[model samples]
Target: MKHPRLFLHVQEPALAAQLLQSAVVKRFIVVKSSDAAPWSEQLLQQSCDLAFIQADQHSEADYQQLLSSNILAEMDFIFVSDGNPEPWLDKLMRSGAGYHFRQPLDMVCILDTLQDFYQQLSSTQQQVKANNSMLDQFGLLVGSSRSMLKLYRTLRKVAVTEANILIVGESGAGKELVANTVHLASYRAEQPFIAINCGALSPELVDSELFGHTKGAFTGALRDHQGVFAQAEGGTLFLDEVTEMPIEQQVKLLRVLESGEYRPVGSDKCRQANVRIVAATNRDPQQAISDGLLREDLYFRLAQFPVVVPPLRDRNDDIVGLAQHFLAYRNAQEQQQKQLSTATLQLIAEHRWPGNVRELKHAVERAYILADKMIEPDHLLLEMALADTTETELNEVPAGVPLEQLEKAAILNTLEQNAGNKTDSAQQLGISVKTLYNKLEKYQQTEP
Candidate 1:
């Protein structure tokens, strides 16, 4: 509700008084300046939101002082000059003036210009507030590695589209962060962005939870409920660990995707949903389909635009940046400033981050709480040697294991954990079913 402050500088006291008579300029301070030097100095100290300077009969020293004032950087200035503004207008604009007004200025036009300026300023302030909130809450993905840069570029491009995105990556790889960035950048940014973990729910409950259910729909259906689809109307729904969704639930999800309509569990009436779908998994979905754990059609539907988020170990260059980012965040929370030691950074870079970003975040938080001053190498508790063992064991065979064999094993492990569902598996793996299938086929062919 705060109004912008406008300062008017004029050499003619009569004209300045007349301009002040206008309702639009009534709130402004009109100054009759003999030279621009005093006005320029005052402009630098005062929080002037906008400035109106009369350019008719101005001294050369006044012009020089006005041009050199640093206040111009923060204030939007308009020049009121007699005669045509053809030549000087461009110069004023280049010198940071907002606009140029010729002589015989209509009061109505001045009012309209002021209104427009305020409106634009309000809009810009809102945008800046929103951007700052996003950065404060979500922070950057925090990586300078080539793989991370590729992921960042891909995320930016994908955010502009309204496609059904399928994110595939290992557990703890910040899949949810990617989902958040997409929602923040997308057109539906002003709407709700809801995230649900499919693997956390049982097969029987997932249907009711996702599609909603009516009172007496099942054992615990005390009352009618709105599902995630309904809750995320006109927004986005992020389904995490999607491959864990049961085969029955997958069919229901596919129907929703295809028709944009879904019925509550115990209700026959179908409701419309205008929601964007973005699913993530840390498991290979293609292997789930080959193993008869996932449906092929559903896999393709959710993978309209598939993006793979690389793990932390794979993007080594992002370690220091991410570590520093987390450290700063923790420092802010604790109200205590602490820096990470060089040795700690080196150790962190050398260690294989199996848990990915989530794990790294937790580790930093823990270190911040435990360490009294600087975070040293000893503060980090990562098991370096055993980091790749799980992935390696999943890849090995009796003697010579084919690439496809390893992929199938990885997929099967994820499917079993997810109870034989591909959507949830793909969400867990953080890769599209298309990519999952490519690995599946490659592994199948290597079966001796």
Candidate 2:
């Protein structure tokens, strides 16, 4: 009564009848002929949960035909192979069979195995449903541009393995998006994905934030804390702006990467950390090393599988697609739909997006909020990009300007504009709040 129906693809009448006698199998379909293809299709159409295919009872031709049929595609196949099951079991498993059993089945063992299989099948179905729901909400990466295609291919290749990845690009270059895609495609998709910015914390606080600390480790340490490493165990730990980590902390981080072990500050016991590190840095790590900002050894350790996320400016062909994508995203967030005009898209494509995808995203968000009807070129505000340059130059300069000064100016402007709200300033700047604090500290130290 537990299972309403079960299908048995067995030519042996005695075995079929004995199996049907079980209290769980209320309804049964027994295939007694080699040409039982129509029955198989009918069983599938009827939504049979389990299919027992007896290899010994059926002819080789019949087995081959069933295996090749589309009816078996969605079904969970339980193959009952003969005594020496190595060859047949291998073939069946490779051909998408879920479970296998040897001949001369023990009733007790068969019942137990079926119960376990039912539980597993239910769990798998639930997981697939959840995944489909998430995909529907997030939407797939939708671009056919050569750069996007290349990035997609690379992401697929890297997702199957366990390796440290370093995503390098200028700010707004979609580094985090790439990291998410890597996680989604990887074997650890079901595991926790925790992201932290090394550039966001001070040298004194970065260690405790990453590896945690015991109670009373520092002035305000209230209780024993589980840092990002512990939180990201068996999953991914995405370190954004890794080059911003102070040199001293980099040495400790390098040790953790090499040994897969770390201890909380003011604690003697070492904890195992099985996190996959995927670091992203806008700064040139090699240059950072040369400038005595980042440790070279740490850079090498983190760069096990380095990937450069191309800047938006470099992928001009993807602009329209990305713009539409952003507009759709904004529309969903604001609960209103909008479209971009051809002239509007053309203007967007013409600009030099020094801030990269982050800048483009901000642009779209601002336009969405401000536009009364259809989004036009005039509705777009390039002030975030323009604030970095002088008003005269912003109007006169035909070519693009250096981004470093622009970035610095933009950061300062946001800080002042937000009344020193570091979190909001960081959000507007497209950098971590920790990075904003670091910049503030740096500015104070060198202030005249």
Top candidate on lDDT is 1
Give per-residue lDDT, candidate 2, residue 243. Answer: 79
Error of 2 at 123 (Å): 37
lDDT of 1 at 436: 58
- The estimated TM-scores of all candidates read 0.56, 0.58
> lDDT tens string, model 1, 303-415?
98788889887876566667777776566665878888888888777767666775566556546644679987745544322224465543322345455433554564554
TM-score of 2: 0.58
Error of 1 at 441 (Å): 35
lDDT of 2 by residue, 1-448 (tens): 2332356776568767766676544333333334635444545455555677666633455455556665444455666667664554465565445667776777677766665545333312111111112111111344444465445545555555676888888766767767777787777888998877676777778878899999999899999988999998888999987877887788889999999999999899999998888999877878878899878788788886678878777777667656777787666665776878888889899988666665665566556655666988765666443336467645642245456544555575465445334567788778887567666556434421
Regions of candidate 2 where Cα sits further than 4 Å from its true position = 1-142, 333-335, 383-448
Candidate 1, overall lDDT? 0.67
Each model's number of backbone clashes?
26, 4
